[model samples]
Target chain A: MKTKQELKEILDFIARYATYQLGSGVHTSRAVRNSRRIGEALGVDVQLSSFQKSTVLTVLDPESGEALTRVAAIPALPISFERNSDLSALSWEALDEGLALDEIRRRYRTLVDKPRMDPIFTLAVVGLANASFCRLFGGDWTAVGIVFTATLVGYAVKQRMQAHGVNHFLLFAGSAFVASLCATAALRFDCTAEIALATSPLFLVPGVPLINGVIDIVEGHVLMGVSRLVNAMLLIVCIAAGLSVTLLMVKDSLL
Target chain B: MIVTDMLLDGLFAAVAAIGFGAISDPPMRALPRIALLAAAGHALRFCLMRHAGADIASASFVAALVIGMGSLWLGRGIRCPMTCLYIPALLPMVPGVYAYRTVFSLIMFLQSLDRADGGVRYMQQFFLNATVSLSVIALLAAGATLPIFVFRRRAFSMTRRK
Candidate 1:
């Protein structure tokens, strides 16, 4: 059995590693800043070090000049004349007094699952759609209903093609186009009171996250929130690009 | 059928909450346990709302507090920096819907080619509904802190006795 001190050390290491990998995936800068702050606040006394992507380079402590750790985060490819290197911390350690392997595995799994099917995010999208649809066609959800159904179909198509390594930007644009086309067709053809339903999905696109990002900026989490907002807006821009192609192709008299 | 809707909503909310809560910390045994706590919270909130007509925000807060305090009794539950699953999962019931409606309604008015007066009326409608709903959610979240107070007081008293 591992001693209490040994176990804590392992736990601390796992915690730091998990946070590092996940942070790199999302906001790396924020993670780096937060980690540095946490270390300062906790008064952790371990020496910190960094290394360039070469065999003999190491960052020594400013005061002691002792090399802390050797690192090789990025490797160079000798292809193009224009090549660049990225810096990364190879690893760090913390002493968690009571950590377990099973616990680490369990936490890792949960952390991985969050970006997928997170209910609040989905509900937020749905709620915004419901609200906007009701407002636009209050007691008149015809065309929006068509849009909603079309969007679902579009989503289904995207999912199916996803396994074949389809470009996500193109997939999303195609889905939005299909939704818009469905609404447009319903309006021009049967005059079914389903336009609201059809257009509903189009409206569901990144508006909420965009607005949220803006709110985050206003609240001064400028980088953290706005980057999220920008990503959402870019998705919309991709969809709009897809939609404009179809819209411009048709005659002005289609109204 | 109405009961089914309410139950489904609560159940979905619970599943999502527990799942989300387990995200940041204390990975082991968080979901099933958090689910139970969420149920108890909802039940308490339901009773409070029905019998005492407690303010909506206050009711939500009290219920959340119940869940938080009960977590201690459950033994070695997760501790996290942010609100974790509670806020996000609780968000469905957060009156965000009302806030959304408020904005959407105003947009419709602005889009309309009709009388300006009608547009203003919709703008008012959305804002009023949003205010009431948001107020209720905020109050309940606040009231939920009562359990924390009670827990702290009990701890203090016990320490004094010790």
Candidate 2:
């Protein structure tokens, strides 16, 4: 026999829980599963109608017949697998321990407040990774060196622009243009100039959205799936637009 | 010679996975698992393509299947969802060349629409590249997510406390 206040609190918690997962790049099916798991522990039924921008979640208190529905706009958080994993674990803890909302919320706060990997370190690693990608594509050592330098410069620009709140499409285009333009230095060496150009922008491939979109569609979340795929496609086009500029400049390379 | 190539393939993929996996901010304990998964999947794909005569699409499907199963088992130890482990591992295998070629050829196709023979050649290239890219992408997603459906209870409860 839960009170109305209790029902509302539960509903709010569930909504916040699901929206964070959505924003942090969990697919639709998993978000639903985790939210419902929490709701079940709280002795309520949860239904979510999730879209690209918002999620409409309804909570039914079966005993009191008091239902509450709320729509939460998903935040635009950077994709954090650590956050996603901890949040999912939190849901399981709520279910397994039947923890009260205050305790659950406290744990959630701690998890979210945890510090992320240093951006400088991440940038360095990504530069190295993109260089490895160039090598994997059969670029010569000279081409790899060019790509390494190019990725360092381009990713730095991307990080700075992203921090300044640049639109993502523009960010991607600018980064690709910068990276590929730097990679074109390989042309003078008579080495794998084309391979360097091709691989310089591999770091911006939108892998998560591309894969998550397909998963959502396969799991029957059609609307969100389509929206994600469309977003990824646009980013790919932006990448190509940037590359095309370089291609136009290096027409003789014919890559 | 073949063994050296495969080892190089695995080594590069592991490095790539660690770097890309960092971008997503995964838990520190999960990086090693991501590296191992990427190495195994990418190396196997290399072998299949180089020695077994498998096309990129089919080889990718098999590699992703291996990654899916590996993550299902590995994720439980770390109390993380399989998605966290497999997504970065699969990044190196993305058909970057095919994806870009598709876009490059599409632009070429559109530009040459006035010249019949040129248009025909570009159109053919565009479709060929697009088909390969889309098929590989679709298969990778399907193969990775299939294990979750097959082992629903285990997949969903990987984070559960005993």
Candidate 3:
């Protein structure tokens, strides 16, 4: 019932919204299910699947959950949004131009059915979560602050990173080291653990990947979801490795 | 871990849900709505966890299901994705920690029992305890969503269910 162009707009909106979850490691299948929900709202039956890269998506009608005859592309721009961003640049009214309401609705359905193509949001989220471990454990403010640092670094580099890519791992590792590097000092010098516990919020910061991972697993993409999760788990392992090294290096300093 | 004990643990689960929502739609304005849902969800999960124990997963899953029903019922005008709204409010409650502890402690128990040390039996007891705890957590989650399910038909009619 919807036009191809309207579907494109809807998919673009889905992609824009998805970046938020990707940064938290929540998973993307939520996006798929989410798209389906949106499709239902528009009175259409559609499903979306993301490729390993690019904004290209494989869309299908929900009755069969198979790919539509054609592939559509949405600009994958949110991978590089600034820390605590405002999306005023992406005005809803902007999409209203040159398209009729019924036509817009049709395209929107098709668009919402497209899969997300980027993993930077996913990669960055895992980094933020790993950096939060110390804070979540009731550590100091420094632990929390470091989460912010990781967020900045991850946000800065996510666009350039890839799924299961070397830089993705590096960004996560770097964030872990930097966050814990500061945390190590705080653990020794910043006084009691409770005094620093408030800082955990800094670490608790960020959310995209957490959402993506959950969505993926819940939607039943066992391997792809697990791989993303495993990749995140590896980042945590590396963080622990880095933290252990920090602990080993600084062991004699505190007592 | 005591800091995250019981009710707080449950409350934080809702936080995870919000975090999940924020992740999917970064600029989503419905975060505060999620906050409220998290509170409602935590309260429901608390009642169920406090009672049925093992059904916690079923309860929470029901919470998620009710959330879907609620969205369709109440969020008619605002244009929110129901899954995006509902899932995050439930994110903080997933039983990963229990699963982690169960599997980890189980491995240790099996190791101890295999070595035939006196600690083996103790480890076995711990394994049982962990398993029971995991079941309890799941049941609580499942049961908590019960009220939502019953009330969901009428529950959705009142207001914006974001």
Candidate 4:
């Protein structure tokens, strides 16, 4: 029922949607699966290839044997599980109800533009989580208080650096340095400085990427897995570099 | 005293998972499940370490396996991706202390490079800490994802359904 040009436009939008999902940190197979589901719903066949920083998607009209291929360079975006869930749900709806292309496009646009969580709320939760880690590791009330404040300050710095579009490595390093430095206050106050220092930067650990890297390798996406693992290792090194400065400065006192 | 400690640890793990779930911006509906999974995993690990004398790597592996299976089941029940449930839940088991110690010892080793006795000790400590940290991370990933592979057909069918 649709002309070739209109179908091409739909395929392009689907490719962009797939690229966005990939960029937002969904696993390769899931991204591919979701994109194919949407394409099939609209009566097309989809093929996807993902690399470290970009994705290639092709949609084919089986009846006419016409194909449209799109290569999108995905700029990094902060991972949001909320958006991933919403998009997946949207694709399912399209498949079940046979939604029109215009309606699907409008829904996709709204999903992408959904407001993110409040920055203040994010800072507070990260701080609380880190502080909880301190307690779980046996820090006393005073140490928990110190770690809470330290994480709050550190996470705020991280948020600010991200807002300014600073380099990722530097942002992590700076946040770690600030966190460890502030955690020293626990020592000054006779609290458990060791626990505070160890836990304050727990929030900065890239748990998702580390897990995703292993999953990718296990699932046979070796190149993507290796890249993700290397990136995570580099970030860990940056975090250590930042924490090392604080440790060196306060070496004598702590020792 | 041990029982109380384990209970407290589980409670903290749940709270930490909730906070992390919020920070990651998962759907509000998913937070409770994340908290429950985290608490369950952390408690399981703590029990293994305290009662069975399991090493950090083995304990983390078992705990992560539990969390992974739980995530799959829960994700299917809730009709969302398994990752939305698992990543935040697994945060509590990340071995932060070992990682920090690995870095600290490595730095000390580098600084004492010219020294004979202390440098060797620092170097040994660095290797020990790094080995433990890396092993735990590796095991965590392997154990958590093993179920997905084992139950591949079920996983695929569940996700593919309308």
- TM-score, chain B, each candidate: 0.64, 0.95, 0.56, 0.92
Best-to-worst ranking by TM-score: 2, 4, 3, 1
RMSD of 3: 9.6
Q: DockQ-based ranking, best first?
A: 2, 4, 3, 1
Candidate 4 lDDT tens digits, A90-199: 78878988987889999999989999899898888888888899998888999999999999999999999998999999999999999999998987887778888888
**Could you give the fnat of all candidates in order?**
0.00, 0.75, 0.01, 0.66
Tally clashing residue pairs in candidate 4: 0
Q: Is candidate 1 or candidate 4 better by DockQ?
A: 4
Q: What TM-score fits each model?
A: 0.44, 0.97, 0.47, 0.96
Q: State the displacement of the C-alpha of residue A237, model 3, in Å, after optimal TM-score superposition.
A: 4.6
Q: What TM-score does prediction 3 earn? A: 0.47
Give all candidates' CA lDDT scores: 0.42, 0.89, 0.44, 0.85
Question: What DockQ would you assign to candidate 1?
Answer: 0.04
Q: Which residue pairs does candidate 2 place in steric collision?
A: none
lDDT of 4 at A89: 79
The deviation in Å at residue B41 for candidate 2 is 0.5
Q: Give the TM-score of candidate 1.
A: 0.44
Task: State the TM-score for model 2.
Answer: 0.97
* lDDT, model 3, position A52: 29
Q: Write the per-residue lDDT of candidate 2 for residues A50-157, one digit (tens) a residue.
A: 999999999998988889999999999899999889999999999999988899889989998999999999999898888888777788899989999999988888
Identify the CAPRI category of the predicted complex in candidate 3.
incorrect
